[model samples]
Target chain A: MSTNATTEIVPGWETVIGLEVHAELATATKLFSGAPNRFGGEPNTNIDPVSLGLPGSLPVLNEKAVELAIRVGLALHCRVQRSVFSRKNYFYPDMPKDFQISQYDLPINGEGWLELADGRRVGIERAHLEEDTGKSTHVGGGGRIHEADYSLVDYNRAGVPLIEIVGAPDLRSPEDARAYVSELRSILVAIGASDGKMEEGSMRVDCNVSVRALGETELGTRCEIKNINSLRSLGRAIVYEARRQVDLVTSGGRVEQQTRHWDEAEGSTHKLRSKEEAYDYRYFPEPDLVPVEPSDEWIESIRAALPMLPRERRRRLADEAKIETAAAALTVERGMDDLAVEAIGLGADPVRVLVHLENNLADGIGSLSAGPFAALIAMEVDGNLTSTQTKTVLAVLVADGGNPAEVATELGFEAMEAEELEVIVDSLIAEHPQDWLAFTSGDDKERKKKAGFFVGQIMKVTGGQADGRAVNELLARRADA
Target chain B: MTEYTARQRISRSEVAHVADLARLSLTDQELDAFTNQLAAVLDHAADLEALDLTDVEPMIHPLPVHNVLRPDVVGETSDRNEVLSCAPSIENEQFRVPPVLGESP
Candidate 1:
């Protein structure tokens, strides 16, 4: 990974990177068809005639796809202007439709910014909406395309809406590129735009990397690495490609601009094809589908419906809840930050609730919606149950869905009156006379600690019904007397 | 007749290259026919450019909608038999298809 830093090529070489990340929108149906948008389905089972690209099958826009696109646009802080789909004229066996319906000149999202962890902001050139092609699986020996006897095509993913976000050539290193992709995925998931699962083909990235002399004005020959599925692979590919380009240039060999394949095992990019010039994919407006214009009112409604993004929510959790930054980050990372806030809103002490969630409650609950557990915490905070009684109530809540107060009553956690607690404190002080004497004496701080020990024992005897704060105050008064 | 002449910007070679990248095999005659047809289409597009579209924002989709989100509930659809019935091949309750080159062994 430090190959670039360790070996300086040409005194100073700067690496420039740009990315095109395709994220399948988390919708139930295909972008331009009624076919199901599901992964790992039986081949062709999710397909409809439109997705199969049959003749006379006019594509109908999926309203859900457009909504997801707009949600992404708003999350990226892009200008979601009225956009149009154009036919990217191309023919592929995988592409059931000869042309991919994609946005070209007028993308749905334009000119956004993504801030990386290192505080560097990468500009988003455009995020266009497009339909995905079908999958082609090559059959027969060694998985080689030429050696394959035949290929099978699956239309399950066909016509699925994919938002391709193109980033500017602002990423200087592989780390920045990976961080940019990671942050983008988080934002998409936060806004309910996409699942952003790279393994399931819900999110994928293609990186364009180039290396040029530090002071040079012209960019180097850039190579585009296709379909890097994971962030770790993305970082490795960028590093390896940058190093490879630098080695070629420094060795007096010309770096060929081309599309390359990232061999995950080899940790390098092998040449796939010579770089083609900007494709005049003969992008023209789709004649069949009408262009859509979102009204001002509609756009405003979407904006209003937008949830608090991860970054904003993290800040709010840290600021309002007075939780530690790391703890707040853990909540967000686990996708439970919203649940934490909801639990707090229901009257749980934010810090205590976070601690309980992290330490005790998280294991039993498979997901973040620890509803009854949250209710138990709220009950504890309300002084209706002690912390120990709350734990038992939590156990019952996890076992069965019943009222926490009722469970607390079954376990004898009903709160005691102040007068009853006062009597207990009085008796405890009378019994522990030696400790009370030391507590009254100004010299014995250690004995005063023993006095606190006796108070705790008295409260335990009272079945934790005595409020600890009130017990302490009563103990202090009796000891001084 | 409108005196609009469509400019042919893309050559035959470029069309062939695009087709190859997309992994579709087209005959020579088909390529030539598509080139001319695409040129005519572009000419019509040029006419659209002449229209008063300065204030008319380009529309992307048909409807005005936002945040059409589904609750992240795992829906009750685990019918593997129904799904695998459509596959050309299946093994171990999974869809079996022709392997692609460059995929990991």
Candidate 2:
């Protein structure tokens, strides 16, 4: 775990990075065909002739992909415009279509900004809608494409709608790059536009890395690093690639403009292909598809459909409650912002609710909805149960759905009466005469420590259901006497 | 009938690049022949520049309808067994092809 501490690279070189993130839209059908667009289907099952690029088959645009593209645009604060589809001519078996239908000069969304958790904003150059390709499974030696004896293609993923979000070279550190992807993923998931699962290939990142001398306005030659499948690997790849570029320049070798594949096992980037004047894609308008002239009304409707985005929700939660930054980020990241807000609205303490949510979200929320969970916390707050008793009731409620009060009774946790608690505290003090003497005779510091020790001992006898505040009152009276 | 004058000759290397992009293996003679043939076709289409249509909007398709989009609805998908049957070879129900030189491992 590398802390976000600034590490000077070769003393003077600063890393400049931009990222292109390709996210598969959560649509029901392919971008241009009616074939089912889903993940993990039987190989080639989710494909049709249009997705398979068969002869004489024409493509009909899936309106859902367009709506999702606009939803992302609005969430990212981008300019949604009348966009056109063009053929990005390329050769790959993954795209059975000789040319991919992508937005070239005019994308649907343009020029947005995404703010990271630490308030660093990266500029989004464009988020263009395009079609994804089929999955290729390589067989034989090393399982790498260059060494494979044969390969398999699964068209199940083919023609899935995608939006390639291009970012400006605003990320300065490797950690910022990771934050940028994570922040973007949260926003995508928030808007319900994408699942944003990098491991599942629903969201993929291509990093463009360069290094320049400190305070230099011009950028050094950059390399595009691909195949980083996780957020940790995304950060590691940028750091390694940036260092590699710095080493190349310092050692008097010019950094070549190329595409590099990040080898996760080796932890280094190897040259995939050197660019020969930046890929002449020879883009032209797709004669099969019509222009996407979005009406203002349609764009407004899409914007209205978007939920509260991640950044706005984070800011609002931070302002409304004095939640710590990390806890607030987690609350928003896991789609718990609304729950936290609703729980707070229902008179639960904001900080405690968010803390409990952050701590207990691992094994899934189970059957504990915010209303009931808030009720459980309220019970603890009102001295009906101790914190330990509350946690027990919460666990039972989550594991087995029931009213928190009912579960508390079933767990045999009832608030101890004040008189009973005082009697129990008196008995414990008599049993531990020296400790009780220290509590009454010692200074305030020793009193606090001894009181804490007594509280632990009393909790054990009470089965962790005794209220500590009541115990404190009884002990303070004994000391006064 | 008016004849379209030839201009902007296509280079043989350009032809070869296009063929490579299309994943076609072409010989030198085939590249030369394609260069001349594609150049003539482009030159003839260049006759469209002779017309003055500055006021015209660029039409993407010949169909009368614009925004010919299907509703965002899920429809019937082909059966997996039926779709995989169309492939030349299948392993684990996926289409098997000769390993391409540059693909994700």
Candidate 3:
């Protein structure tokens, strides 16, 4: 919302933000273990020897997880290469293996670009395959969470296939970060790689935020905000954190490199740790698992099978409609772009069709075929039905497939004849000559107000079935006379 | 013994830090003994490092295989009750451990 946030917050200060998104690949089994990779189950019910980190249990890579990761790589325009898995050593209660298998130096997907909804391309550094950790529930100590006596953990999610997407620090505003995640989520879902559900923790985000004076070449030290789950939270947290950094710098304090946690309820960020105490995740390649070298033929097959991504789909729809891509974004997001495009192809007014889609049909695109949808638009376009009547007919048509005309007639939504509307408008003008004078001679704002008054009077007489556009045309003719 | 004494490859403090990361409690005597013992292992590795093999490609594993993947099918899982019975602690059919308060939430 703050396009000029730089001026608003200490004139020269500019905020820099980068995002790291972790999405769970929709696979049947764990990344390296045979345990079920599911969202929720009875605790420990989905565990295997590998998931539980039992002795003598070795991990074997899941082919489907690899394929899904590859799908993500190709969708992001990355080079899918042979990747090695490294053991990130750390001690955590939820990590039964005392280490997480992740991609360290060599990632499967490297150097890609994700285009924002506004056609701004953000550079993607890498998207590597990894395993998710188990869920932990802190028990006891009620209000004082740090004082909790113990923690309970469920291993159901352990070893679930995950693709950690690392985005370059290209985002400046918080809004762009939200757009990046939303755009990325749609791509993930459209390609059938991830469900992209942040609420369920299937998709997670961490942002690295820093601020420096505008046009300053050197980058500021960034603090990593971890586990931001929702798009709204991502924006709000960035705004708060950026201001926090700006204030700290202005107060003769240095911004230390650290990991911070966003407190949604407090609308502030709290320090989780400083760089000094950061885990030296003694990273070494996992000896148990072999390198994942995907063949070129297999990569081509995945690339061939990808459906049209959301970006190209939005671009195509916007080009066909001859409108801004942002205007067609919602229609595409709701999976109605094809329907809107097809209706447009059938000579339906693109603007009106898009407007109808934006106003109505939000719940669903309805089972009504493109032909009927086009016919309905045509009826409205020809002034045979008011947009309101068109909506009434559309509801029935969407609920039940039938002729648009028949549906209109069945609903008693017959568009008023032009002569009938003309007669009503003439009489109303004669009755209210003073208002008509204001409408004709008044300023632009006054005319719009008086026009609304006439439209209201006309709709009252016609039982809301008159075409507003037709009534306007009749009013204009009468005013000229 | 002579080979290990040829050079003190690993320091005692480094060994102590590694032991600390593993959460292993060791006395000063154990640290001194392990430092020399572990230095011998590093000495052998230093010999390999000394070899001129710049042309040889770096290999992470000796397996003649690259991709050893299994089908992503939900197969056998450990019995919850049986697994819980062997655990150090269990609460609400889940693994129970002392509350971890550190780098991550």
Better of 1 and 2 by TM-score: 2
lDDT of 3 by residue, A388-451 (tens): 7888888887887889999888888777887888888889989999999999999999999999
Estimate the lDDT of model 2.
Answer: 0.83
Superposed Cα deviation of residue B65, candidate 1 (Å) = 18
Predicted candidate 2 versus true structure: per-residue lDDT over B1-99, tens digit per residue: 222225446777778887876679998877766777787788777788788989998765566556668886766666768867877888988878887
Q: What is the TM-score of chain B in candidate 1?
A: 0.68
Candidate 1 residue pairs in backbone clash? A83-B59, A83-B60, A137-B98, A138-B98, A138-B99, A292-B61
Candidate DockQ scores, in order: 0.12, 0.48, 0.70
* Top-TM-score candidate index: 3
Two-chain DockQ for model 2:
0.48
Distance from true location, Cα of A316 in model 1, Å:
1.0
